[model samples]
Target: MTETARDRLIVGLDLPTIADAEKIVSTLGNDVSFYKIGYQLVFAGGLEFARDLAKSGKNVFLDMKLLDIDNTVAKGVENIAKMGMSMLTLHAYPKAMKAAVEAAKGSDLCLLGVTVLTSMDEQDVIDAGYEYDPHTLVLRRAEQARAAGMGGIVCSAEESAAVRKIIGPDMALVTPGIRPAGADKGDQKRVMTPSEALKAGSSHLVVARPIVAAAEPLAAARAILAEMNGALAR
Candidate 1:
């Protein structure tokens, strides 16, 4: 599918307060249409904030990364489905994935399986007692997610091409750790440029600090969107 700039980008609202999030949205205005509300904002009672965004016609990607038993995760998915969210994320464990798929059966919610965080490298995977490297684990979990009927997988751009080859064309690949050229990598270990990630078959790019911490967040977002549009055109 052909994607517009807004369709391919997701801005992460990792701020601590709803007021801060409101300010950012007001600053960006219609330039941004998709927002990710993760644990920090949700823990700060940003559910109402998220609902307001949805009511204003913005897509909400709830990135809580649900990890729990099948029953609990199913219940959680059911609850979120009623919130008019566009997408929801959960760990790519088989039982959790199956439950999530079942819970979202009648809703418009897209269940995204988080394969591996962009912040973890091979050594970190080893330290976590995983026998495989980061790339290998991402592939394994992605396959599991697809098999279990997830809408997509959350992976880094570094592995997006390989994942695309594995999962085929229809599934979504939401990539994070998107750094512009010369931008700080922060705590992210597996990172890629916005164009690189798009070329590697990322369906959507999740960018936070680069845009949020910029001297001018609107300009930063516009530049990234232009970069994404360029990549899609190629």
Candidate 2:
């Protein structure tokens, strides 16, 4: 099925509690369909909540950023796939991604290879013991993800266009760190407005604070969706 703008917009439920997540979900209503459950939510009974959302016909992106020995990674992927997750993220390590791809075979789960944290910049990459800068490293990992026969990539929108060229058209390019125009960027160092991210080849845009932190959460979400639709229409 062709994707609508709403379909491409993934709201990050980066809240601290499931109740808070529920409140946001209720507020967003039908205006939002996909959600990302990362560390903050995962520890607070978010796994079951993820299942509930999926059962209710919502797509859940489980942002675990998983990395481990091959067997452990494969085991986790197998269970997460059974949870009806639409997407799962693992650090872009070749061995782990290969194991995850193999384990997720025959499942609907799309394993996303996380290239680098959007909050990190050039100095951060060096601090992490990487010789290459953020942009170059993101592309290198994108290459490995493609070779692993993985489903997609998680990258900053800053690198989406280049990553898209490397991964080609079919793979999902899920971009996080999305900020609307004039919105406070918070801790995210790399961000793009919804339209800019979409035009740069981001297949899915994950937004958090811009929507959830707004006094009117629903309005913020709708506005972002409107911007996304406009970009897509153009």
Q: After aligning candidate 1 to the native by TM-score, how far in Å is the CA of 54 from where it should be?
A: 1.0
Enumerate residue pairs that collide in model 1: none
Task: Give the Å shift of residue 69 in candidate 2.
Answer: 0.2
lDDT of 2 by residue, 83-139 (tens): 999999999999999999999999999999999999999999999899999999999
C-alpha lDDT (0 to 100) for residue 20 of candidate 2: 98
Q: Worst 10-residue stretch by lDDT in candidate 2?
A: 1-10
Assess each prediction's global lDDT (C-alpha) against the native: 0.92, 0.95
lDDT of 1: 0.92
List residue ranges in candidate 1 displaced over 4 A. none
How do the residues 1-234 of candidate 1 rate in per-residue lDDT, one tens digit apiece? Answer: 338879879999999999989999999999999999999999898898988898899999999899899899999999999999998999899999999999999898999999888889888889999999988999999999989989999999999999999888999899999999999999998899999999999999999989887899999999999999998888
